[model samples]
Target: MGSRRQFIKTVSASGAGLVAASAMGVMQEASAHPTSVWGGDIYSGPHEMVKNSKILSIKNPDGTETLGVVTPKGVIDVRAVAKKMKISAPLTLDQLLQEGNAAGFNKVVASADKSGVPYLDESKITYGRLFKNPGKIICVGLNYRQHADEVGMARPAVPPLFNKYNNSLAAHNCVLEIPPPEISYKLDYETELLIVVGKRMRNVPEAEALNYVAGYCTSNDFSSRDLQLELPSGQWMIGKTLDQYAPIGPYFVTSDLVGDPNNLKIQTWVNGEMRQNSNTSDFIHNTQHMLSYISKYWALEPGDIVFTGTPQGVILGMPKDKQVWLKKGDKVVSYVEKLGELKFTLG
Candidate 1:
């Protein structure tokens, strides 16, 4: 829930930087010879045949955004090379999911690798929101036992749900404008795992819920406790849904790459000092349970995201004398094992 002003200075020497890995799996090779695999035989229909790959948004100098694939060499500017090769590719993560362009996306990766297009150094590109536009941004509350206990609340029988709109979305390394002091005094940070829905679903069972996930990413449920708990409604939306409050990304890694979503290590830091250290294993309602429970009420479509609840160590759990609310010039970093760290500044 706290951050110091020296984040940018310390981040360079922190070695907690994002690493780009090349695309893996056979989709690249298979697409190269699609006609050779029995042209007139029974149709196998459409399916994603590759391993889950990492995708990101690269902000252009003019402020437009394009999709980039993280490779060992660097970032493959998909749109830049796709046009040069005269092949079609989605320019954003949302388009890649909503249009069912997995096959097309794979082809773009293969072409970029061979096209001699230079990879953009990670530092040279500014990140844009990982999701161009999410149809829904659902959030879960008190889903972790330790987090609930820290606030002196008993576990609820059902998963608590809340919602965030598109305006709240922010990119990794972006700057967040804290609401004027008149609006709130209690700015806090909650590190949570993000779930991205890949397919249209409703009333799904827990057994098959993972199949519907597009991928996973890191996220922060930035909050203002004064507006959240002190208001008349007693619900959390107002305090939690401020502009640039939901900072997510660095990469939207597919489920194939992220083996078990519930067992990974998750942590948060304020100005490089580790404040929260826990694993998703502490979740009271695991991934399958949360998805199944949510889909029962509303249909989840491609590009929809869900913010699973945070673990303990947030300022809200601290004693009144010890709590130091976040303020201007603070840096917050959220990290998950396979999903890279998401860093942001609060001003």
Candidate 2:
């Protein structure tokens, strides 16, 4: 695992050098008004700036550390007391997103915020994951035009999708594992903007697919290029799902608040070095197109994640002479302008 120092160094470099920076399918028609949407009134921005109005840690608001999400009535507390006893102190990301009466969840945050909290200096919180979940995680590879060019591949007309098991999920304070030292080392960091599906939709049109998104988060599609490219056949999935291949989190922002999925900035850093820098603006196939395209093939379900491809500056794109694969203890950080940072250790 990477020490905290390395993680901080990498994240700071990438996050500082630039402003950093999805969804799917359907055959359904969204109403002009999405009144039932959670946090329908919430506006989009960095979590630190507006989470204070969110409800989190309600039951023991002043007690444990947790996220605070903005709600119409005020903030709907996510970590508040649950009806059942023997619950854990902090709630998982998936819990908050599951559809239901947030009433019980809110009560805990309301009660806790009524008192001591320290997750963030300010009481307000933004979501991370809707709640922790057990589900299949899907990702897109080389989905961006510039990224494909950088890697020396022709642009794929359709989204290049891949899979990563739950083990790839990483939240803040995570340490990514570097490839085993003996082989084709070259583990790299990729900055990607990710979205989670809130509802199930199959065969959705491109224009209507965005309606199924629940929220957005940041992810680092960490890869071992050497191992990935080891096979000349060019089947991309093998190199995509490394141990911590996907570092996701910081928080999940609902689609209602994020106006345009294609315009955010995405950036990456490796061990305090600025490596990849760009924006969602460069995507070859934007979210609308991907959603519509993917829907023609598979059904997108709630909690399913879509990680838009990373931008340029990956190691594979670097001149081999100057290339250096991530070693054990290296820190890789992927940041999206609005979603926040996803950090991990390569140990």
Candidate 3:
């Protein structure tokens, strides 16, 4: 990548950031969700595992590891269904690897297939803690060229990384209180793909980075640009951490089924109009290299999230004459493949 200061200087209005760098020779192309046009014929249509689903804590005779996924019409008591026909719920991939758990998971899914639950109207479901991640939340900025230009930031020699506290998490249906009137005037939204770590790992190699990832989801890395740019030292968290800035997820689909994470289409919608649209293929530094680099300093675990980065078309991307910062009554949706759409309204 290019230096943040030196980056925008190189691109006129057309943004040279995407074409300026090439890390994944062919660019691994996978949609954040199966429904994306990026990879046609990739999804197995609409499966029950996703679409109108909710996970919950349940219990049975075998002790625990009992979990249920609520579908559109009702709950699919996975364990209940499995035991009726001799099956089990898989707690980890190890269960799949061990053979026993895989048998049980298959049986449970088979039973669910027979349930009479109707298709869920996604718009009606109540969002939960998408992924109860007990791990660190990591983010990369200016990973997209257009994002760099809007802020007049040069690209970095590597990924422009940062962090946000878990305290900032918001679900798909909550309301974000506009930062206190005393703060910023330029509140913005960043739609990006979120990588959930599936297993514990440290000193991981780029070659094996994908294995450490559990799955993918969507996140709106909301920013108060004025507060973000307030300090001359450019400390991101100041602007990044003002309450309710991160809105993420509708579901957490297993990564094994997600295929490639780098190639998904990322979309952000304000109110009902599309604003930010781009593919992960444009990430100046892709996921594989990012996980490898960060693993050098931090030990990632089963729940850590790596927000790859936002694509072009944010509020900041517009010319000064056309920019309109977000405000109350605004509804924003950030979506990735399989992860579904994360929708929130501002009050």
Candidate 4:
């Protein structure tokens, strides 16, 4: 596992640089069309984005990441195949959805699958953050019935909302550095289903909410209990949005492939031992309800993500004397039925 210093250096040198470049690209695109609004021309719509496919973010040697399509043959590097075929395609997943280029992206995937070229070896490639900079990172707290009971809190009548900034985003198989003991020693894991919105929505009905989602992924809402519960004025944002605290993906399975988002099996294992084993059926506020509720207050844009609350069996649920927080070097794997497992280690 990489140390804290190494993680910071990598983010500063590579990740931050990529963010700046991506921002520039977005600015240029927006400048070309001044009349566009947040959910207007900026969003491409769900029809183009929600195809039945698994998408991967492959890190390039040049400190940038591109989209990779997972196929039966192997992982198709979209950038490599597009270059060889002399065709136009979006370079990154963010660009694919933001620019509404899924048709072009699909064309690249279809061509690469039939070209007979040897695709990338999945085991050999480095994974990148599936989302670099989503407009919003909304989270629902205490939405699970059993989880609320375990934590000695009443089931909330409505979904309690919170937010995490882009800084907390991390990729699959990434190693996160635990804060020093003096800062926070009581680290906990909360595995939950993540919702990726494909279309722009405001005041959307619950019946039409699922239609707006682009896809789903397994995500760990890693938390620091001391910073969350023991701090003055309850610093949920500080406790929840730590660097690399939200590690999502191994793949982003489209909504068509992951039908009935609220009924999937979700689980978490720490050091290969089962910690959370429950289905999304236990959710106090189901997927569509949460989406509809949030949309009433603000517009849900393409690339915005929502983390549904976790089920019971977290370290925080145990009695004070029996609680055992996550330590450095511990491996945690989060799994959802259709979405693949997301693994990360504490540094």
> How many collisions between residues are there in candidate 1?
0
Worst 10 residues of 2 by lDDT: 43-52
**Which candidate, 1 or 3, would have the higher lDDT against the true structure?**
1
Candidate 3 lDDT at 23 equals 31
TM-scores of all models? 0.85, 0.70, 0.69, 0.86
Q: Whole-model lDDT for model 3 versus the true structure? A: 0.67
Q: Provide the overall lDDT of each model, using Cα atoms, as 2-decimal numbers.
A: 0.86, 0.63, 0.67, 0.89
Task: Give the count of colliding residue pairs in each prediction.
Answer: 0, 48, 13, 0
For residues 26-144, could you state the per-residue lDDT of candidate 2 as single tens digits?
21223343332333322132211111222222223344334455444454344433323322223534434444233434445555543333234323442232333435577777877
Q: Extract clashing residue pairs from model 4.
A: none
lDDT of 4 at 156: 96
lDDT of 1 by residue, 1-347 (tens): 13554675577545433221123335665566554221212223363423458888898888977788888889999888877776655677877776665776788888986787899998888999997588899999988899999999999888999998889999999999999999998999999999999888899999999999989999999999999999897749998899998999898898999999999999999998898999999999999999999999999988799999999999999999999999999999999999999999987
Model 3 stretches with alpha carbons more than 4 Å out: 1-124
Kindly indicate the candidate among 1 and 3 with the higher TM-score: 1
In model 2, the runs with Cα more than 4 Å from the true position are 1-77, 83-90, 98-134
Error of 4 at 97 (Å): 1.9
Tell me the tens digit of each residue's lDDT in model 3 across 181-287.
57777888988888777566688988998877756778888998887776688769878866778877665566766778877888888989999888888877889
